[model samples]
Target: MPALLDIERGFAAALRTGDCTMAAELIAPAGVSAGDAITIYRNTFVSGAVKALKLSHPAVERLTGAEFFDSAASAFVAASPPSSGCLDDYGAEFAGFLRLYEPLLDLPYVAGVARVDWAVNLALHADDAKPLDPGEFDVAARIPPERLVLVPHPSLSLLRLYYPGDVIWRAVLERDESALAALELRGGPFFVLVWRNADGVQVGRVSEAGFAFLSALCAGRTFGESFDAAPSPELPVLLAECLAAGRFTDFREI
Candidate 1:
């Protein structure tokens, strides 16, 4: 008799590759043949993974169409099965997969679109955090600038892409034909800010300087260092916008 670990390993391999020979040895014969049962499990696992990928990368599906998305997703699942049981954690490498997918080479921005979608999905599932009030940041202002580090909200993510992925994604999501028509595939070197709020996930474009500033803060750079990294005439305005948008959850003296 196979050990439980061996049985599980065989079952997983069969499900992942559609080859049930190893798993069949472990299964007790019943009404269904072991091979048939393994086939059923394989189909269920693949279908579930495909559905999860569609949800995680809706923009990619929108770009490729359901039929193409399903085909690509099947290949991806076969090559890289989910490591965790949680569906939400699945498809982390999908964007990278799309980058190398030969069928999608002509659509270079497809991978970038997938990346944006993944960011939004991640933001949706990020740990909940409260935004500090404008007054709260005042304390940090009083501290020695070199010792202060602005902490980003747990849900905040910065995405820098060379394609207009966010625009394409928004157009599809909003069902705006005109907006879709106006979008050019390589229309950007966009710096997008993604975060979740009371309403849901929000995505907005940010200037390069703003992106640098936020990224520095997130990396635990001191307030003075972060500001200096992206010093600009619009620095104050960008800071005000960050505060208004609740980008910072707190400030720490580090």
Candidate 2:
């Protein structure tokens, strides 16, 4: 008798690769053939994965159209199955897959779009935390500038893309033909900031300087160092905006 873990692995392998021989040996005889039973499991597994991908990357599906997106998603699922049981945690590598997918080579920006979509998905599901009070940094004031670390909100993320993916994604969400038509994809290597607030998730492009400051802080640079890294002279203004947006959850003295 095979160990339960071995049986589970065999079943997963059959679903993932469509080779049912090993898995079939473990199944008790029934009216349906072992191959037929395994086929049902395979279909269910693939369809569930495809649905999760579609949910996570809706803009990708809209851009590619249903048929093409399903084909591409199927290929991706076969190549990379979910490591975790949680469906929401799946498809992190899908943007990378789109980049290397031969059929999507002509649409170079699709991968960037997928990246933005994934970021939004992550923000929406991230753990909830209250924004730090404006005075929270005061404690750090007593600590030397070199040792203070600004901690980003658990749901905050920054994405830099070669295309205006956030704009494209918003247009898709709004279902506005005019907005879609007005988009000019030629101008950017856009820096987008994503964070979840009390209302909902927000996605917007940030200035190079703003992004620089935020990136430095996120990377654990000291408050003084992060301010110095800002590309624009308006570091104070940007810091205020970040606070208002609830991008930082707390600070720690390192």
Candidate 3:
């Protein structure tokens, strides 16, 4: 008999690639051929991945329909299997995969919608943090702007999409046909913010400047540098709004 580790590796390779020759030699099944058993395992794993993708990218699945979504998701599973055992953490690359997927190239917004879905899912699952106290913001506000760096809440994320993905995500998930119909097909440089506050995960549109500023902060830029990244007259007002909304948990003096 092959060593246990070697047998396990061979079986995994068979499941991933569907080339069961080595596994057939290593795994001696009594009733079913090793190749056939490996095929069953592979199919089951693919089905589980498809289900995970459906959960993560509901908007994409809705837009593409069930059969087509299943086909594409299966292909994705073959091309990019989960890195970990957690299915909930799978399919992070599904949006980018959709963008590169030949069949989905015509409907570009589908990928954008997938991005929105993934972002919301990420925020919902993100570890919770205590919201910044209003008093902390008040103290940070007293510090010289250049010396402070805002520490974003764990759930903060920003996306700049070339389509109105947020609208598509909401409409499809809500099953609002009229909202979908009213959306203009014109291309966009839409900016969206996804974060989990005390209430729950939330998504909202943001101005270009606000996106630039907050993204800079999220990337660990100093407050002064954020203003440099986004040179807007409304920086003060933007900071106030973020503080009010509990966008940051703390501020660091750099």
Off by over 4 Å in 2: 138-143
- Top of the candidates by lDDT: 2
**Position 198, candidate 2: lDDT:** 87
Candidate 3 Cα outliers beyond 4 Å, as residue runs: none
lDDT of 1: 0.87
Lowest lDDT block of 10, candidate 1: 180-189
Give the per-residue Cα lDDT of candidate 2 at 45.
91
Compared with the true structure, what per-residue lDDT tens digits does model 2 show for residues 1-254?
A: 78889989999889999999988999899999999999998999999999999999998888789899999999999999988899999999999999999998988889988998899889989998989877866676688877888888888889988888888888877787898899899987789999999879999778888788889999999988887786577777777787888988888888
lDDT tens string, model 1, 108-131?
888888988999999988898888
In TM-score terms, candidate 3 sits at 0.95
How many residue pairs collide in each prediction? 0, 0, 0
What local distance difference test score does each model get?
0.87, 0.88, 0.87
TM-score of 1: 0.95
Ranking of predictions according to TM-score = 3, 1, 2
Q: Who is ahead in TM-score, 1 or 2?
A: 1
